[model samples]
Target: MSARLATGALVNALVRRAGSAGGFATVLAKGDATAGAVLIVAQDRGENPRLLERGIGPTGDVELIAVGPDGDAQAIADYWSRRRRNDPDLWVVELDIAQAERFAAETMLGD
Candidate 1:
């Protein structure tokens, strides 16, 4: 099996990439640095909010899965808050960009 990137490193890289691309990215909650799971809150300039997480698809390949509410910012925030409460090891990052979902998926699954 291939090795995985540390959660902290990935988070930093993602933030840098988003900023470099003229977008906004920030960590909502910090989790374990070594092996925490990441949850991405993607939005297009603070609109069309979506929650993305890496998960195994039916074909067994890891892919970005859309979880929680869509379009509504408040519902998405509540959803992530609830999830974070349950999984304290989850890293929550918010990305507001042109193609937030694509950026999140590439940065998260590329490594």
Candidate 2:
């Protein structure tokens, strides 16, 4: 499947997972080359610092996940690992919900 389709599927799955826990997840693809913060939320001082050390900064209602040719599943795993440490109470996944929705639609249509 195309990367976009795969990403969409991943997102859709994550959204469902988030929904089960009363949280929400969304996907935002950058049409331009502009890079900026994706999420900004308060974290305790004892929280996991890997994200900060990796330049992730913080987590907000929206968190940024990298998607592209250079992006791989390992990147997603690393992101989640850091996120879990930073917020043990929250659940984070690497799938892209928007992409996942599209994937689901296509799959339903048997495309």
Candidate 3:
């Protein structure tokens, strides 16, 4: 069987990695420790903010899929707000990285 990492560890790893890379990272919403889903919002200085959610592909591999090119703050906030209402255990992380998808690809747990 494959081992999975906990949510809290992933959150901390993300924060530390972003900081070490000279970027900013913060957890907007805390979630369940064991099985919460992670959503990442990547924003750059004058570009559209992109949102990615953790997903499992057909082959059982984890990947980041773009939710939207949401440069609008209110729109992204509103979207997550609606999502938060449904899943109180969902984690939302904001990372100020240009290539934010790499974070998910590198951080996601695997065999």
Highest TM-score against the true fold, candidate: 1
- Candidate 1 TM-score to native: 0.95
lDDT of 2 by residue, 1-111 (tens): 432324335445545765564444443231112222222121123232111111232453222333222234455456655654664433332223333333323322232
Task: Write one digit per residue (lDDT tens) for candidate 1, span 1-111.
Answer: 999989999999999999999999999999999999899999997888889988898899999898889988899889989998999999999999998878888888985
Residue 57 CA displacement from its true place in model 2, Å: 16
What order do candidates take by lDDT, descending?
Answer: 1, 3, 2
Q: Which is the winner by TM-score between candidate 1 and candidate 3?
A: 1
Q: Write the per-residue lDDT of candidate 3 for residues 1-111, one digit (tens) a residue.
A: 666788888888988988888788899999897889888877865356778888876688677777854778778888887888999999999888667777656766433
Q: Mind sharing the TM-score for model 2?
A: 0.27
List lDDT for all candidates, in order. 0.91, 0.34, 0.80
lDDT at residue 82 of model 3 (Cα atoms): 81
Q: Who is ahead in TM-score, 2 or 3?
A: 3
Enumerate residue pairs that collide in model 2.
8-99, 8-100, 9-100, 11-96, 11-97, 40-60, 41-59
Judge candidate 1 against the unseen true structure and give its global Cα lDDT, from 0 to 1.
Answer: 0.91
My TM-score estimates for the predictions, one after another, are 0.95, 0.27, 0.87
